[model samples]
Target: MKKFIIAPSVLSANYMNLKNDLTQCLENDINWIHYDVMDYDFVPNLTFGSKILQDITSQIKMNIDIHFMVKVKTKNFTDFFVEYIKANPQMMTMHIESMNAKETKLFIDLCKKNNIKASLAVSPQTPIKKIIKYLPIIDNILVMTVEPGFGGQSFIEHAAGKIGLLRKIIDQNNYKTTIEVDGGINSETSKIVKDYGVDIIVAGSYLFGQKDFAQRAKKLAGGN
Candidate 1:
């Protein structure tokens, strides 16, 4: 069986002790430390940037996975993020829907040149086909269960079919890309999602919000 990578998203971490919060993710054997780098243009909420990543790189040992939830601009932040990747970033990516086709390709190519793992995400409302058009250029697909920006929303049931369809498309086309599912991925629902064959699970509220945060994260890691 393929290994299930557990990436604990840090959007819900306590800002006061963000480094300490990341320390817990390191303790749990989580696969990657996910950063939700959002700008207000793409989504309603805006999240932290290189300042937070600087703190994380100075302290943590786990692999870094960046989800750039920002609108495509004059390569300002992307230039900053390329600098982040230079500091040994394991995975750095941006939103496909946030930029136009030409820009998306350019961004992915830039990330690849910088040796940062490139990925793209889609909201529950966007068609998976739009994402597939860019698949040959990207490395992973972040399929959202809940809407971006905020957590604590119910998982949309309709997304299950989309996941299954994406799986078929990936396999048939021989794409070596990972299928990552974020939001609402708890132990119970995660097991159910096993049927859809996701490779990475990005857990946010489900991980950091728990009392026994480390063990709960390992539990969601699902049997090694």
Candidate 2:
């Protein structure tokens, strides 16, 4: 069986004091720092950019998952990808929406050359078939329960159905791509999602905003 990874999202962390919040994840041995990169145009809200990622990447030992939420842009993303991969290779994923199908495939190919773990993300409103086209090229699949720009949004219950669909497809095709679910992954929901074939669950508010961040992180990591 594949491991169930708990990548805590920074979207729910207190922006005023990110270091301390990130420290919580490190202290608990959470392996991946799931960062959400959003542009104001793509998702209606903007998030901290590459500079912050550069700073944080230097401090953390765990592999980072840079989930780019912006619509795929080929030229603009080239240098950013080059730089981020230079800082920490083999763990970033640019969103499929950021580029067209051909461009997305090319982006994943670029990541392969640079040793980055490329991934594709899809919004709830977007049809699942759009993501299916790039399934063979990308390393992971991020199924967004809520809209991707900001945190605090509730997980769409129907999102679980997509997991079942992808799981079946993967099974039938013998695909190795990991299935990841982001947004509202608390202890209760994590169990529910895991049962539905969600291999990686990104928990932000569920971990960072808690009083016992360490314990919560452990519970999530242990899939309790």
RMSD of 2: 2.0
Which residue ranges in model 1 land beyond 4 Å of their true spot?
75-80
User: Model-by-model lDDT, in order?
Assistant: 0.77, 0.78
In candidate 1, what residue range of length 10 has the lowest lDDT sum?
74-83
Q: List the residue pairs that clash in candidate 1.
A: none
Models 1 onward score TM values of: 0.91, 0.90
lDDT of 1 by residue, 8-81 (tens): 88887887877777777767776487888888988889888776687677766778888878785665535645
What candidate 2 gets wrong by more than 4 Å, as runs, is 72-77
lDDT (10s digit) by residue, model 2, range 1-224: 44678888888888789888877776777778788888786789888777787887788677788888776554664655666665674466666566776667677877888878878887777778888867776788888888778787788878767888998888788888889998877878877788788888898888887898877777776744
lDDT at position 92, candidate 1: 70
Residue 204 of candidate 1: its Cα lDDT?
Answer: 80
